[model samples]
Target: MNYYSFLLKNAFEDFKRNKTRTILASLGITIGVFSVVMLIALGIGLKNYIRQQFENMGSNLVMIMPGNDLSEGGFSSFGSSLATGIRFDERDLNTISRVDNIDYVVPIFMKSMVVTSLEKEELASLMGTNEDLFKLMDLKAVEGRILEGQDISSRSKDVVLGISIAEKLFDDAGNAIGKTVRLGNQRFKVIGVVEKMGDPEMDGGIFMSYKTTFGSINPDKNFFTIYVGVDSEGAIEGVKSDIEEALLKRYEEDEFSVSEQSELLDVVNQIFGMINSVLVAIGSISLIVGGIGIMNIMYANVTERTKEIGIRRAIGATKKDILVQFVAESVLLSGLGGIMGLVASALIVLVVRPFFPVALNFLAVFAAIGISSFIGVFFGVFPARRAANLTPIEAIRYE
Candidate 1:
């Protein structure tokens, strides 16, 4: 057989001879690999979950809020001087809708009022929006229908209760729909109930027709918040710019802000990237410990095989041959440990998937294995060289 094959055969035999030690060493590597792999999987899963949550809110929707400039000392000074006087009216909406790449535009007006059902009453924040608002913002009715165009044209008092509001006032899901609810002494029929959109305590808000809210209830409140949707993903930035330009031209002020879904997603992804980096750094510590374990075991092996090294030197084995054999053994041990660690990592991902979101990335697995094997070689070199360099007389004399 070839010299390399002979070294490999002897290495295998030595590994098999000390099964317990081999298993113990492999266990250490397995633990390290498992931790690193699991952390990566968890980070990926969390990133995806956050992305999905944002997507559910609306993928293409952008929210524009009044920005306050510290230098100017007011919300109006931050954007355009006209923004201070300009209430987002139908004229503004019409102008924005005419902008190229804009698919839909809707304005929102909010009011805090006491809403009373036949059985009970509660204070809630009511939002007024148009039909396009439902489509643009992913607002859907779980029980009944959303506000219609007729509700806006005729100034109807129809309202859609938030999931939390529906649960608190109504006995069941079905009962909440078609029930009459009084909003700040103004009676309106509840046409729909929003589905439980998770943590309603945080985002629980009611919806109503824009005309009824702005034209009838509070004609004095002229200003409103606007939501705009771009026709396509590629057009989002252009649409935002066009809208800002149009608004600036009309009102002669740049007092508005535009947000894109892609920008929001990028922020979310950056957070996830940071989390993964931190986790990977933490997991690297285990690898260092495993490498130390390898170095220690290789040193011990050198001491125990002193006589064997002397014999090999006596039998026409060159220093290079001896070096290659010992180094091969160390590499073999570490490579085996890495393989086991990779297998354990896969099992860990599978086991923990039900409890937490985990996705097995083959690239990560291969990377872990490669890194562990490299560590083994790096730490194993010194001891392997010491064994190969031992003088035949000195090694033969060693007990």
Candidate 2:
């Protein structure tokens, strides 16, 4: 074997002789890396889930929200507009509806509250919109029927339950139809159950007529956001321009934003980026613990191999050689553990992907390898230095 390979092989043989110590040391890194990989995968899956939701909502959609929600990087709120921005009203929708190339316009009123059924009370996202919402989103009724224009015109307190919310509150989608559910202080009859759209925000939402919603928490008839579906992707730019011109008549430039689907997706990406960074920090706590274990094991190896170190020294092996050998062994243990963790986590994400969106990416792989090496070097230093500093005569006489 070449010099470095010999060093590695020697470390391997020592591990084979003390399998338990090696496994335990490696196990520390394994668990730590597992945490890191799984967390990053969760972040990636969340972004994917959001993108799917956007796609399901249809293409070339335009949205106007109460904020300068778009960043300089193309769109997402600077966070100031949603807090204190002017909300849109029905007049705003009317003005935007006259915009050429717009196929459908729906004002969105969102409220989060507990909806109670005879079976249970569950928190639900209530989406208030017109019948045109069903058309633009291409939502289908899995049971009963969706809202009709008559429902909005009459301000009827009829609701369409998304599949997840219906099941949670009534124990079955079939049982939810014609059932009475209380939202805030108003009781509404469930008129339909919408099919699962593979998005939690849609699947778990309770859809209601905007007219009826104005009677509940939205008494002033103002909306948080407005959705406009254009006829074609080619029409998106024109539609956005038309929308801005229409709304500018009543609102200031900074008080609102008109966004295309792609801009909203950019915002989603930024959000996931921040969230993943946090997850990595949290997961690294485990990596630090694993590093400590590796450090402890290396210290023990130095004690056990004192005489061997002394004999190599007497045979003209330098202190740097002894240090490098022990450090190599520690790094080998850490790297093996990291690889094992990565493989195990990949298998887990694959198996769980059908139900959850967890994904494995190249960034996660590179990160695992890089972090593992860093931990190996960081934790291996002190123990390797102690071994290197051992006096030849003292180490030889060590019993």
Best by TM-score: 2
TM-score of each: 0.67, 0.85
Q: Give a tens-digit lDDT track for model 1, residues 1-399.
A: 988899999888888988888777766676777778878888888887677666765666765444322223333244453345346677777778898877677788777778788988887877877788778757678899887888877888788878888877886668888889887658898888776655343135678777787645667644456888777878877887787777777554435555565665775687689889899888878877887787888888889989988888888888888877877787778778778777776787788777666787787788788878887788888888998899988887889
The pairs that clash in candidate 2 are 69-76, 69-77, 70-75, 70-76
lDDT of 1: 0.75
lDDT of each: 0.75, 0.89
Candidate 1 backbone collisions, by pair:
79-254, 79-255, 80-254, 80-255
Where does candidate 1 stray beyond 4 Å? 1-9, 16-20, 54-60, 65-101, 106-133, 137-142, 147-226, 232-235, 246-256, 351-357
lDDT of 2: 0.89
Error of 1 at 51 (Å): 3.5
Please provide, for model 2 over 140-233, each residue's C-alpha lDDT reduced to its tens digit, 9 standing for 90 to 100: 9999999999998888899999999999988889999999999878899999999999888778899888988885478889888889999999
Clashes of 1: 4
Query: Best candidate per lDDT, number?
Result: 2
